[model samples]
Target: MSGPRTIWRSIATGLGALALLVCAASANTASAQAPPPDIGFDQNLGAQLPLDLKFQDENGETVELKSYFGKKPVVLMPVYYKCPMLCGLELNGLVRCLRGLNMSIGMTAEKDFEILTYSIDHREKPALATQKRRQYLAAYDCPAANDGWHFLTGDEESIKKLNEVIGFRTQYDEITGQYAHAAGLVVCTPDGMLSRYLYGVEFEPKDLRLAVVESSEGKVGGLSEHILLYCFRYDPASGKYGLAIMNFLRAGGVLTLLILGTAITMMLRKERGMMESHRLLEGSTHG
Candidate 1:
């Protein structure tokens, strides 16, 4: 049989080697799958808001980006109101998430934020905006309609400018008869500057709140800022926003294994030392 010291060393070495293998496997997988591009906000966050872009609302009233600034943070989405799949799903998700939030776009006595859904399809009519707004509003449980949401339609020039500024690349897929685009939400400061981009359909309410509050520069309250610290962030490799699952999981798993390995190593070392001490004492007594 191998000596106790050798056995202990072997066990420690085996565990360490196994842990390293697992880490290498994880790293390889991550490397093989690169993340999307970075579309997150920076110091020049809202400068891309096309101030000259003008779109008409459901009521046919012309609205400009400049008109929205300094009033309330805008949750702008570039979606064709007629989108058959992802667009509807995205809107539904936003509505569902917003319904659970305590803050109201218009009703919270402070006029905190507002929702604007801009139709990227220039051919989309104001009537379509009216219809979509009606459908979503009918389903919306919020009673404060006066200050909260607005569905808008605009001409091609306005749509193009707005889409370009927001980096919303949408294409008409004739084969599918649908717009091929990524699903996301963009938060703009009241001054019409882009602040945060929440990519994906289902977004956390806390993240939405922080984006609003931060864009407002703490002008709006009654919500916590903690969620923004750990919530969904932008990844540049994939060119779309998503939940930060890999980062969190990787960090958590590595730390856990490190702790377990350290404990096991210490225990094995202590056990081997005791065995050596016993052997030496016995030898000394006999001698």
Candidate 2:
């Protein structure tokens, strides 16, 4: 029978070997998949907006996307006000970023531009919209003078239309009781055309301002619109559009390397122990 030390070593080696195999398989799988092509900017930045949906405003007044055109630039966001997790964070991030901007929503307090958040979840009622709007407005801490922000909810047809137009794809995950949706903010020209896209939770103030100014045809100004030109591009491989890979890989590569290294170390330690044990047993037999 093997000694306790030898038995323990054997168990450790087995576990390490299993871990290594699992890691190697994962790595192979990742690499085997074709590398996604780099996504660049969409050339049709000024194309007309997609589906025209109808949603109720805070006061239950029906609001249509087409109506907003020729009025003021709009910040279009798709979110379910009742979302328990990421939605709130996304909104909070936007509110924080907007509050820090030197520019106000409207130039003369007549609602120059509007921040419209449409609830993708059709079940969401007008009351929920009001509550969410109030909650976010309170957090925003903007003076009463700034009333350009709006929260809205609509029926399925309207929601689908708006989502389709903006390329906002989302699905309900029954297991998690939550919706899986991409997070981003879109800037539309006053004439209801796609202007720019800002992906992820935290948005750059300069980018946001630039998008607004560009969408306004260089009327509003803070920074150059060139920065907003390629805020987000579409990648064919990932089957989803997002920030450039160079930026994504910078954050993802470190964690990946750490996991791979740990698996390799465990595997090497396991092999060494097995070899040492075999040598010890052979020596004892020869003696």
Candidate 3:
């Protein structure tokens, strides 16, 4: 019995040590994959964009940031045009989402919106911006995209200021001559006030549409959109609009009451018509 008990104890100790080793290995791997301190987003919701900042359009024409604002909600993306990897993915994902939208860009009659994509690296020139713009516009395959989407390049100072206002932190890697940045986009109101920050390269078309509509402040979108906005509320943490259970219930209640009222009115009108017919018949019989 003593020999068996000793053997069991030794086996238990060995298993415990193995478990500890596995846990340590996992922890190290997680730490290695963690993003560096400088590469992340500090969401600054409702921050006012610096409209006076100047940037060169894809055509090399200098334009004020304000030029893009005050007309429609702007979806601003900060990315370097020459980026070999992540920037392309972000742009492709954005184009896919835009294609999913029922509305086109720059049509005031429909759900109007604008896309402003600027290079974070000042070293990138208008030529690169032009190349990217052409590439994406071709992929989007929307006639309005030529007017609604803009690609821009700016000097270092202006770019830095814009990034700071939006709380987009990035780190430059000297070893690779590349920048590390978190993936996201900012939606601003027509008046240049930052309204929402949507995170990640992949986004839902519904999410983008709602953000644009909310930022527009009833300037765009249709009646169904208004009802949707009423039923759903944006969650800043999730960076998405979720169904507001209470609001949905309230809307349901209101609709139910409206239907009942309409039905009752119709029934009353029918009864009145029948009574009038009976009275006329009785009068004719008595005559």
Candidate 4:
């Protein structure tokens, strides 16, 4: 027994030494690597937007960010036209989700929503924005796409300020001459308050539509969506809405009770109507 114990102790000591060596090597490798991108999605939900900044639209006309606010919620995306990889993936994902929504873009439809995309690359010109818009709008191919989607460009200061409010981060890679960014979109309320955030390259249509509906504060979606809100709640860490088991159970129970009560009332009314009809028939016969 003592010999076996001594052997086990020796093995443990060796394993601990090996783990320390591996950790030291990993630290050295990390230090040698180009610093990891500072880009990521931070969920700053329910924050008020900074709408005072200025940006230029696709047509080269300067526009106030606040002008896009009011009356309808906005699906906001920060991307640069020249990005070699991640930005295109983000846009493609966004368009895919948009195609799934029956709702149109622009405030002309009370139930519709809008998309506001701005480039973080301060040096990008309006021509690039215009070109990007035309390409996407053609792909979207809806008559209302003309009015629904807007591409914007702005100076570095304005871009930084807006991104700061949304907690979106991006960094330029000096070695690669490209921008590094995470994939996500922000939804702002009709009055320009940050409402929902969705992360990743592929967004679920249900998630996208529900996010827009919530941000609109029931001004856009029907009663069904409002009912769904009762069962499903937003999850901050995952950046998606998930099921609320207890709330769902409670809602189901109440609906069942209401249905049973209505059935009983209907039966009572039918029984009373039959009795009155029978009494009237007997009285007529005796007369």
Writing each residue's lDDT as its tens digit, candidate 3 over 6-52 gives 99999999999999999999999998894655777777988899899
**Top-down TM-score ranking:** 3, 4, 1, 2
The residue-level lDDT of candidate 2 at 277 comes to 100
User: In model 2, what are the clashing residue pairs, if there are any?
Assistant: 50-165
Which 10 consecutive residues of model 4 have the lowest summed lDDT? 102-111
Candidate 4 global lDDT: 0.84
lDDT (10s digit) by residue, model 4, range 45-148: 87888788899999999999888889888889889999988888888887777666644433222237778999999999899999999888776656655687
Candidate no. 1 TM-score? 0.62
**Measured by TM-score, how close is model 3 to the native structure?**
0.81
TM-score of each model, in listed order: 0.62, 0.61, 0.81, 0.80
lDDT score of residue 114 within candidate 3:
81
The residue-level lDDT of candidate 4 at 62 comes to: 92
Order of quality (lDDT): 3, 4, 1, 2
Name the top lDDT candidate. Answer: 3
Specify the poorest-scoring 10-residue window by lDDT in model 2.
102-111
- The TM-score of candidate 4 is 0.80
Candidate 2, superposed: residue stretches over 4 Å from native: 1-44, 50-52, 103-112, 144-146, 222-287
lDDT of 1 by residue, 143-186 (tens): 66544788888888888777777777766667777777888878
Model 3 global lDDT (CA atoms, 0 to 1): 0.87
Quote the lDDT for 205 in model 2.
Answer: 65
Better of 1 and 3 by TM-score: 3
Lowest lDDT 10-residue stretch of candidate 3: 102-111
